[model samples]
Target chain A: MSLAELIEQRRFVGREFLVWLWFESELFEGRFSLDALGACELWLEGQITLVQEKEQSRLKGAAPSSAPEAHEALRQGKLPSQARVRVTRGELEYAFLFNADAFALAGVKIPSVVKDAADEQFYERMYLIEELETLFTALYGEFLALRLSAAWETGVAPFVRAWVRGEPVDVAAYQKLRGKLAPVRGAARSRTTPPPAQAPERAARVVA
Target chain B: MGALKGSISFSKFYVRGELPDGFRDRFAERIQLRAFRPLTVEEDAEQRAGWCSIENPLDCELDHGKIFFNSYLNLGLRTDRWQVPSALFKAHFAEAEREHLAKRGREKLGRREKEELRAVVSRKLRAQLMPVMKVVDLSWNLEAGVVRFWNQSPRAHEGLAELFEDTFELDLVPESPYTAARELGLTSEQLAAFEVLKPTVFHAESTLGGAR
Candidate 1:
């Protein structure tokens, strides 16, 4: 098959990856610890757009990632197409609208570029872009590792199935899978901040 | 095009195939713009698409490992006869017909003949007009097998891909999660698992913006 044909055939992988990230963000309560990258938090913020192309319908939610409506749309068989997401590592935060179809991050708002020297301005911007790309690559690497693992079918898939079906998910089973996840390759290990605390109501969403 | 300044929005692609013989010199020759020669109006279709180096406007050269150029394209269309002011065209046509009859002793003109005349007039008017301009930046790191394009819109991407293929004779595969997975060089079983992996909902608690 041609390269274009191959890409077209595999476009759903990106869509599924986005949806899976949403699932992980919610399941792990936004804080995921890659083997060596320390703990990082990812949140769906600003705007979320869920699309069901077959149904010719789209659900848009400006609410936070934890919003029930967004989950409800997922239950109705919609996949996230575009979402504004914030990724926090250490004391830094980067926000961008990710489009799954194109695998493009738009309107990226990196942490402020503070430079005293005028000549260093270009290098600073490039560094920021590379930093953000590295963070995203680390997350993707973690997802890939978990996805291809032997435990995925035996452990992780069942919990996700139960959750998507609106059934009572087995948290113990989910935690077991999480425990087995290895650190992504080349993940940074120097982050020092503690994982952010989760609200009580946020935990309730899983049960609700 | 100069220094990679400011926040850049681009699409990344994995370049395929080795550079052809005399690539830099041939590339420089390919992008040089020819002197202006007006296009024939008789031809219904003409493509004003080519590449020109952004840095050296006067000459085309890839001085360093990196080459930045603008893919330029232009398209032109004439106003339809039906879109012309009906009353005004009718009056003008009548006067022209009278003048033609007096000059050449012709009666009524045939449909094809009238169309030919209309096309000639449309071409004349269109000559004074300009084609729509489209310019997009491309930075190719020949050794790194990476290319970054400024425009990510679907149409522009298609055009860029086609232009790149035409120029370099190489395939540019967009690096997506799927393609990135392929690049990892996984085993067959792992590849199968990658294909079937479904979404998991992580139920981690909220407080994304709150103090830890």
Candidate 2:
């Protein structure tokens, strides 16, 4: 199905489900957004197929290939596959395939700044670990160690790679991270004081 | 009150007589005209004989202020507004003319340079004029050649249009965009790529170990 259609169909889906799917599948919860999901769905529609495994019931079919082979074949041993799932009010598309162990790592979460909104299709990415930590710390400040672990599991690794390479992440996660970090940023701003003015000579010396 | 803290450019004026005595004096004293380097004149026997020499020059000599005033007046006429007085108008006109002359001195450039120059001029004019008009809210369009002067009061627009036209020689048309994009240091290609791959959703079809 087209991304728009899929998103529309799954528009009622929650962000948590999408987050869980992304985390469990790729473990690379880079930037997350509905648009990213939609694009993935569109891309997957052009690439994947679903296959079901069924055993040959009759002896006429011939002897089983081997004990382990029969068992492996029954489980569809390492089949190449792809699927597109829509989530969050049908606003995002998640495309995935049953291949590669790259998605086994912990999820990464990065803080995002909404640099431009006119082109809702693309966003600016900044990956300052401190910024991410500050945001999470502010959002779940009360949760202590549990929240930190959750953040590590869901946000650290993916966020680092995405931020270092300056790649986009899931939009929803980006927004959530920003929301989490807002209070911390505000507190930092409030706590800081402007430097006092110095004598002209001192200023000149500093400049020199 | 504190000299407005920025540059001011002026354009057209329809004075009944010599600018009202008090207005002229206040403008002359309060408005400081930034001076330009004097132009070098070549001495020739024929030129000297015709009274074009240093002692007795032409009847009407060009100063930075005069050039600024003329350009500012021309800009006012084009935009159908007048916001500059003789003093402020002359100062801005001179600056613009000098810049224009300097630009003409360049030898080679491409389309991008030309576009950049135009954008720079547009931005400079806007920056200088916006402050003088006391315009708190305004929008500028470089491509369309328009500047929308907006305020809570309608009467302010009348005087501003005239003052603006008198200062800059460009027409100040009025229209505003709902929003504008702020640059974030990303290349156009990167922005395009980010837009395309930004939305991807992943799903797990089956368990990793196939326990379920």
Candidate 3:
């Protein structure tokens, strides 16, 4: 379904939409205009674009230096020799661009079922835009939850055991593991100070 | 035109109860956010003076709490690092397709025409071969093809190859060939060392200043 249609259908009903309208009304103060709304649309679209670009550039073989190599490889009619496999739980699909050192998780195009539901609820109330903002936030949160859960099931448990035991981990095998473990090592090493004490609530959210 | 497109496909599995040790603690530690000084009032006033005025400075706070994660894994196995929501995924695709069309000077088409074109393209692509088995992951290579699917799942490998052969009426190699090529591209032993990394971390900081 189209975005406009999605917005129309999902226009917040009841308190959800009303709360959004109230908040937006307070923020825009009745000064909202179609142009402003259009601008917001563009801004949101732009964010998706940025995220997509970041993902594409991040792929394994898509590095700056390697782009030339990739081009030459393509020009020489040499198909890419190595392929990376990305596995996740659930019925989600991802598109990726790859380079030797990195692979970007480019963009996500959801299935029609999800798209239709979202479009159906896109804009039912005058405060539809505000409702959408909330929806996007919630959707992102859900995405993170899915990722964390999947990682725990697939990679985290294995990695933690290896790390704690000081076992000689096959770095290659670990790389094949999922979640944010690889980067965390880099981040942790760069830090001289210990991580700040986390609040109980915030900590719970992360673990949950 | 540079917008990327694809879908997020995942499956759910249950682990028998008996919690893993330190799992909770490590997860909590990863999700925690570091503190940062709030933007001073003077800075805020300069930025939103005309656009928005804040009546209560102390009452204003911004919540930026989006967590992005990634992983590194072996060549053939699947790793669960992150899940992209269906809603956001479609939105991104629609937005990207629109941008791509606009870049190609196709933006002037009527709404119906645009829809027709999109349908035609999607149909043509889908028909090219293969029933989608398990979509291991989707990605866009800005340099080569706009989209590529890795068929590592046994079901996908078996299904897609036959689908492609029947649908497109072309002789297509098994999905493993494509995967093998992908593996070859990562000769640095890098493909085998799949690492999960966090892309972005969002936080909600309680600020001392208001917009105005």
Candidate 4:
């Protein structure tokens, strides 16, 4: 396939990535520890936009992701296309609207740069933005690794389905499955692809 | 654009292709060659996009010292366009057209004549005005092969890509799901799967908008 064709066809993965991140964030209760940056808090905040074709819901508030309308949109097959996200680590706070389809960050509010020099501020801003990208990349890398694995069909999707349906999920079970996730940049280990039929959630959409 | 100050916004692009061995000098020379030039009223071109000093757009004199900061290479993509207000232009053109026709002892101007007269009037009016100008910051993290263009508009992206490719001799692919995955260092198999992956339905049994 042409690069353009591949990019156009694979656009859905961007929204799926956002949903996966939201799922993990809620599951882990906003506490995340990654290899690059030890521990941080991440969550959707301020605003969120979900869309399915021409229909769209733009929710704005302190916690739009946690609202019933958000789940309602999800239940209706809408996926988050963009969201305001806040990430805090120690004394720093970074907030921005994440454009999921493009994987672009907008209206970014980085932690204050306390440096005295202009060059220092520039470097600090760049560093802070890179740090933000690192966190996002780590989460996306993990999501991509899991999404391509057998565990996605046998484990993650089911758990996510339960959560979407407003059912209780075993957090420990999830932790165990995620524990098996391989580093995205590691060598490609052979894994059998399960028949798509095996994962009902991957095949079936919620009918409005 | 925003390296110094503003509400931060941008679209990121990943640089592809290798740079030549002695890149800094060649790059700096090319940057100076393509540096932003102010518009002249005599030109037919309505607008132009070119490289400039990221620190000060007005300071178009670019050198290695101005472009480089630590590991990052920064430049401003400044665009200047003649944006004569329509109402103002029409009123002025009407006056110019009247004077030309009256001086020639003619009742009406032909299509071609009207166009030429309009251009003349535009040139005269333009000399007294400034072209609409905008500057967007373009910062390249050399080690990472990432270019953060401090503007998200499609037009800006196109202008930057065109100017960047022409100046740096490298292609830029915007950050997308696949590209981002590649940048994150996905394995071959995972990268291949990225091609065929489908959307997930988090609530399969529920009807669309059922919760509402």
Please report the candidate that would top lDDT against the real structure.
4
Ten contiguous residues with the weakest lDDT in model 4 chain A: A199-208
* DockQ, structure candidate 4: 0.25
- Chain A TM per prediction: 0.78, 0.18, 0.18, 0.84
On residues B112-183, what C-alpha lDDT tens digit does candidate 1 reach at each position?
877766665555544655544444555564544666666567766776777677766789888776666665
Which ten-residue region of model 3 chain A has the weakest summed lDDT?
A41-50
Q: What is the lDDT of residue B52 in candidate 1?
A: 38
Model 1, A163-186: lDDT tens per residue? 665556566656666777763444
- The digit string of per-residue lDDT tens for model 2 on A51-71 reads 233322111112221223322
**TM-score for all predictions?**
0.69, 0.16, 0.17, 0.90
User: For residues A1-109, what per-residue lDDT tens digits would candidate 4 score against the true structure?
Assistant: 8876776777788888888778778888898766445678889999999999999999999898999999889888899999998888888799999998888999999
Give the runs in model 3 whose Cα sits over 4 Å from its true position. Answer: A1-96, A112-208, B1-33, B41-212
Evaluated on chain B only, what are the TM-scores of all the candidate structures, in order?
A: 0.58, 0.20, 0.18, 0.93
- Pairwise DockQ winner, candidates 1 and 3: 1
- What lDDT is obtained when candidate 1 is compared to the true structure? 0.58
Cα lDDT of model 4 by residue, B1-212, tens digit: 39877788989998999988889889989999999999999988899888888888898888777887756788898999999999999999888888988999999999999888888988988998999999999889887788999898887888888999999999999888877777776767777877777777776863322112
How does each model score on lDDT? 0.58, 0.26, 0.26, 0.80
Find the candidate with the highest DockQ and give its number. Answer: 4
**How many clashing residue pairs are found in candidate 3?**
77
